[model samples]
Target: MGGAFLAAAVLARLGGRIGLPTIPLFILAGILLGPHTPGVVLLSDPHDLEMLSALGLVLLLFYLGLEFHIDDLKAGGRKMAVAGGTYLALNVGAGLGFGFALGWGTSEALVLAGVLGISSSAIVTKVLVDTGRLGNPETKPILGIIVVEDIFLALYLAALQPILSGADSLSAAVMDGGKAFGFLLLLALAARFGTRVVGKLFNTKDDELLVISFLGAAVFVAGVSEWFGVADAIGAFMVGLMLGSTSSGARILKLVHPLRDAFGAIFFFGFGLSIDPGDLPSVVWPVLAAVAVTLVMNVLAGLGAARVYGFGAGPAANIATTLLARGEFALILATMAAGAGLDERLSPFIAGYVLVLAVLGPLAAGRSAWLARVLPGGAGVCAGRGAGRGGGLTFRRRVRVRGGWSRSSPRPWVVVRLRAGGRFSRSSPRP
Candidate 1:
């Protein structure tokens, strides 16, 4: 455990200097120090970190829930639905088609649909924070889309489990799906109406007690959610939503930051530990093809979201690339497939596909300016009509002043329109 933390921290620190996102770096550290690699194997079995990884996932989602305000959900309800629906339709449809094209069994195709369709919530949240886009306008939609995906994941898992188990009747799958959906509805009601009760339960003055309280609630709910056929992440997120509505939400947010960061790193590192590099080669072509398909679909989804929200090319590119990675959920699906006696190839194909995208997603999101330039509207397009709604690249010119023209500051041309009602802005002229 100590070695895992040190390895992840060292690699992430080094990667940060080179302008790389920490997620893939953490994962890379795991891969290098894991049993699959030749030198310096810190842990031979990935399962050693399983509980820690799960905690990491829970904390990440809990933090995301804390940050996501209910008002945003109410305000952009329709837009989020539209954006998320578009994303799912495009990606899930493409995944199903690709799966069938592979001539794999129907069960394998079903599994692949989920693996390829869903984005990694953990990766997406980390990307937004790392890139400082958590406060951006498009982030609302991105997070909203993730919420929609989590709901879909519940139903998808319920349905898939029955199929994988070789149940004779479709009624079993339907029953399971209904149960999951019902559980979600119950949780939603709690989030909507149980905030006051929850707040009182957790409203102690001491930070230590507060931390223990929320952590216990999040982990307990997450575990219970899995028992009810919903994703544990969703359970944690719901807990976040409830707690975020309370008066202590801000304090909780500040306190949980370090915990979230630490565990989140362990989560990705544990993911890296599970993968065997030798298994990736046989599925290389399929993985590449899946990656290509995911890229194209994400771009289209981003453009569609931009159009719906009246955003410009820059925000559109950010939305597309930021949500491009596939991680935890894909791994879960791979595990299910392996257990169900599906095609032997599904596991490797998923591993390779996820590894490539997990590394590529952050790199692309950070450099979205390139994609923005190539988009339909140039990068110079106005991001939003009003001040705080959206933001984009703004060009400034050197103006002649009383002193016979003030010297143009270095990189004076471009500025980033922030989300603080356009009250504050930053210059980032670099491409």
Candidate 2:
């Protein structure tokens, strides 16, 4: 554990100097020092850091939930659904086709569909924070899309379990899906109606007690969620969502920062330790093809989302590239594939595919301006005009006075009015 932290810190610091994101750097550090490589093995077994890594993932999602308020969820519910649906349809559909083309069995294709379909919430959150784009106009949709994917993941896993287990009973799969869906609904209800009670439960003057209280709640709920077949990360996120509406939300946000960062690095590092560079060569072509498909699909999805929100090229590029990576969930699927005696090739294919995008996603997002330059329309068009979802149109008003608007007051008085769902604000002029 100590070695993992030290190596991650060192590599991340070095990568920082070169303007690289810390996520891939942390993973690289694990790869270099792990047993797979023939040099100075810090941790021979990746499983040694399993608990810490899980904690890292939990903290990362929990922090994301804290930042993502329930009001934001309600505000862009419809747009989020559309954007997320588009993303999944393009990527998952492509993946299914690709998987069948590989001559893999039906089960393999199903696994591949999910592996390619969903974006990495952990990596996406880290990128948004690392790039300082948390406050950007497009981030709301990005976060909303992630929320949608998390919900979809529950159902996806439930459906996949029976197939992997080789169980012929459709009823079993439905039962499992019901369990996961029911658990999520329970959590949502708690987040919606139980905030006051949760707030009181964790109301403590001391930072020490507060930390313990929130941590316990998050981890406990996450574990329970896993028991009910939902992803633990989603559970942690729900806990954060519930607490975020409370008065202590700000305090929890402040306190959880260092912990989240520290454990997050460990999570990526442990991820690296599990991967063997030797396994990548066999699946190189498939991985490259998957990456290409992913990039194209993401770009299309980004443009589609941008069109929906009436954003110009730059925001569209950011939306596409920001949600490009596939991480933890893909690996989880790989592990399940291996355990269920599916195709042997699935694991390595997923690993190589994940590693390439994991590194590429942040780099592309950081340089999204380059992509924006190549995309049609001006980069700054409709920039900062309105929040995502209902307010895509911007209205400009010019109070022309004497002398035909003199040079002293040349620019138009921009009274950016929002016309959402065909309903204009009552305060705005009727024009």
Candidate 3:
């Protein structure tokens, strides 16, 4: 385990240098270290790695739930609903259609749809921040759509367990599905109305107590959720939603971030250990096609979502391009399928797909402004009002740091600058 962690950290650093996202890199490291490879680093049993990975999923979803708001649609209004609904419908439908065409069963197709349909929050956020578009106008709809996706995914995952497990028969699956849905509906109600009760119940100034209390609640709820067939990750997610609404949510989120990163890296790495490298080549073409299709749909979905919310062509295109990367949720589906003994091909197929997209999707985001200009409306965030090739935003003012503006720089710091010809370029933020 120690060796695996060290290798993962080193590889992650190198991957970052090359602009590959962290989660995919963790999987790549696992693949390299896996038994199927040269065996430089030995990966442990698939079952054991999966156990650890399960914990990671629980924490990951819990953290997201804590950050998510169930009543968010009320705040973002009809735009949020319209954008999120259309985006999900289009992407998920694409995924399901693609999956069925690949000859997988209905259950397998549903999991595949989930893996392809959702975007990676971590990757998209990084792209936005790196490109200095974190505060851009289109960012709002992008985030709104993400929230919508999260809620839908939570419901989907809850029901997926029974379908995949295949305990008794179709009727048994329906019963299990009902259990999951009922649990989720109750959890949602708690999120909506139980914030004050929880806030008052768990009030504590001591950081240790706060952390213990929060983790305990998350674990307990997750266990109960799983026992009732709602699934542990979904249960943990509901706990997060419930806790996230309180006054102490921010502090809890801050404290839990380190754990989230550490466990999340392990979770992604464990997923890699499940696949054999030799299997990848057989599935590469289909996975690549899926990646390409999803990328196009990502732009179209983003554009359509933004348009529904009254954003212009530029912002619409920007939204479409920015929402392309798929990460954690995709991994969760792959991991669950692996545990359930589904088609052997599904695991490696998704692993390869995610690995490719985690890198390719972000690069595409960089070109979204350009792609939008090429589309029918032919307008994009980087583009301008007239015809022909459109222009992107560029910074003209002298760079500013903590205090005042600087004409030049002394040493160096991580500085992000937006340009007309491109989405982001590097510049010093010197005082």
Residue-level lDDT of model 3, residues 321-417, one tens digit each, is 6677777678778878989988888988987887777666666665666666676665323443221123344334455556554546553444554
Of candidates 2 and 1, the better by lDDT? 1
lDDT of each: 0.87, 0.86, 0.71
Top candidate when judged by TM-score against the true structure = 1
Ranking by lDDT: 1, 2, 3
Model 3: ten consecutive residues of lowest lDDT = 380-389
Local error of candidate 3 at residue 20 (angstroms):
3.9
Candidate 1 residues 267-380, lDDT tens each? 999999988899999999999999999999999999999999988877788889989999999999999999999999999999999999999998888777778777888546
- Residues 1-431 of candidate 2 have per-residue lDDT tens digits of 88888888988889889878888998899899999999799988889999998999999999999988888877888998998888889988998998998988899999999999999988998988887666676888898888788888999999998889989999988998999999999998899889999899888889999999999989999999999999999999999999999989999999999999999999999999988999999999999999999999999999998988777786788899989999999999999999999989999999999999999998887777667666777444354322232334454445344444233465556354443223334344422
Considering TM-score, which of the candidate structures 2 and 3 is the better prediction for this target?
2
Query: What would the TM-scores of all predictions be?
Result: 0.90, 0.89, 0.74
| List of clashing residue pairs for candidate 3 | 66-240, 302-320, 314-380, 382-391, 382-392, 392-420, 393-419, 393-420, 394-420
Best candidate according to lDDT: 1
